[model samples]
Target: MAHRKVGFGLRGIGHAVVNGVGRLGYASRFFLMILIGSGASFRRIHLTIREIYFTGVMSLIIILVSGLFVGMVLGLQGYETLQKYGSESALGSLVALSLVRELGPVLAALLFASRAGSAITAEIGLMKATEQIAAMEMMAVDPISRVVAPRFWAGVTSMPLLAAMFSAVGVFGGYLVGVVFIGVDVGSFWSQMEAAVDFRQDIVNGVIKSVVFGIAVTAIALFEGYDAPPTAEGVSHATTRTVVTSALVVLGLDFILTVFMFRGV
Candidate 1:
């Protein structure tokens, strides 16, 4: 019994270490490819533009609607709390700060992970299983450039734009709640918000975080999809892993950005 327990413990530790190292190695290689321009092809750029249009722009409607509701809820809740403290005038600043500094990027990343990450994973996994990737390689084509580069750049490029859109819609939502629903003065709300929030740092941080998240999501999805086993079950597993891992990475990056942005504030 003692020997068996010792062996199990050792095996578990080894598994954990291996998984950690693998993830780190994957991230390093993905970044290195981008840095070294390992796969620069005209076909890749065209495909990437198509993907950007689909994954980024096509996703705007859902993101906007979701942002509107989130902002409305935040304003409503913040108003109620501030009312209790007789600081109702602070609602605009609160909403703007929250949306521009954190919620906008994080929420958009989550939405993108669900919409784009899953699609990329499924598409690539299908290609892998159907032997399309193999066929391309057999034709002396670089699959990374043809397949992965476009999706990776699309994600990185779209994330910041999506974050900005989310912020704009969220601000409008808060405006509606404050002026129409809560009967707060429009001028006062805007003035207070402008006074309280620093657009340079706060908004910039949000946009930067979105780009980083994009890179993480696209890389994870592509890596998992490319490495998927040659089976239907493997494709399904890759899809799930892509979504879950992207979501976790988005949240983790959010935390890191928050810490760095507000470290001394």
Candidate 2:
């Protein structure tokens, strides 16, 4: 009995490993197909643009609102913490560094995943469930080019702009709290932030992070939707999975990228 139990456990582990590797391979193939089809999809720029409006424009309000509130909170927290050390004036550097280096990209991506990513997944999953994708395939229309690639590229393009907007709005929100409300010197607030936050080191790296996150989140959304079972329950599950998986991927990728981008610093 003991030997049988041990063998069963080992078999389960082996099966899990194989399943994980198979999923990875499948996702990789899907990604490659998107890349290859992107050129042809570009000619249908109008479709991509419509998707951008859906994915990017639709998410802007929430992103901006969240950014503003987050910045204000950071400013308040930074001021209170720095006051103990008589360094309240450094609030600008604190807020700027926090947002530009981490919050801007991570939070924006999270919001994007929850909003646009889930929508994309559900939309595609429903199409699959309704036999729309099958019809397209039968008509010799490449769904990868017609459906997936455009959405993927739109997301990739939208993320950096959204991150930039988030950072900009966050800075303004911080300024309102620190400089106007709390009486931190306005000049010092802006100047200190400018001095400490290098465009190349902080801003550029943040943009890079957002771009990577965009790709990961969008790719997962498309993959889940494409792989979902052909049923209403499957569409719902895929949508939920998109949000959960995208969030995890964004966070994990952020950690890996941060390690490489700011290793010594």
Candidate 3:
């Protein structure tokens, strides 16, 4: 009985691994197709803009509010720690570096995944369930170009902008707390931040990270929705998977990108 259980467990592991690889392969092909058909989105432009409105504009309230809160918390924590070391003037550098280098891109991406990514998954999944995609195929309308490509491009374009807004608003929140509420010197705060946060090193790298995350999140969402079983339960499950998988992928990619970008620092 013990030997049989071991054999069954090993077989299950193997089967899971094989299935995972197959799904990955299918996703890769799907991503390639989106890239190939992306030209249509650009040619029309309005479709991409409409998707941006849905994914990016609609997400602003949550992103801005979250960024503000996160910044306030960072300011409080950083000020507490720095005061102990008599380096309170360095508060600006601390907050700015934290946001621009890591927090802004990562937190924004996670939020995007939870909000817009899940929505995209649900939308496409429902379309599939209703046979809209099939009807498009029958009509030779090229659903990928008409539907998926615009969304994918919109995500890729919106992510970096959202991240930038998050970081900028976070900086303001930090300023409000550190300078206004806590009575930290405004000159020292801005000066230290200006000195430490390099444009090329920190800002550009953060943008790159956001863009990569956008592609990962959107692609995962699209694939899950497209591949969802044509049922309500399947669409719900696929939406859940979109959020979970995108979070994991974003964190993993952030680590890898940080290693490459900030190796010594």
- Using lDDT as the measure, which candidate wins? 3
Residue-level lDDT tens digits of model 3 in 19-110: 99999999999999999999999999999999999999999999999999999999999999999999999999999999999999999999
Steric overlap count per candidate: 0, 0, 0
Q: What residue runs in model 2 are displaced by over 4 Å at the alpha carbon?
A: none
lDDT of 1 by residue, 177-249 (tens): 9878988888878999999988678877878888888888878888888778879999999889898999998
* Stretches of model 1 off by over 4 angstroms after superposition: 34-44
Residue 226 CA error for candidate 2 (Å)?
Answer: 0.4
- Residue 32 local lDDT, model 2: 99
Q: Candidate 2, after superposition: displacement of residue 47 in Å?
A: 0.6
TM-score of each: 0.93, 0.97, 0.98
The TM-score, computed over Cα atoms with residue i paired to residue i, of candidate 3 is: 0.98
Score residue 176 of candidate 2 by CA lDDT: 93
For TM-score, the strongest prediction is 3
lDDT of each: 0.86, 0.95, 0.97
- Using TM-score as the yardstick, the better of models 1 and 3 is 3
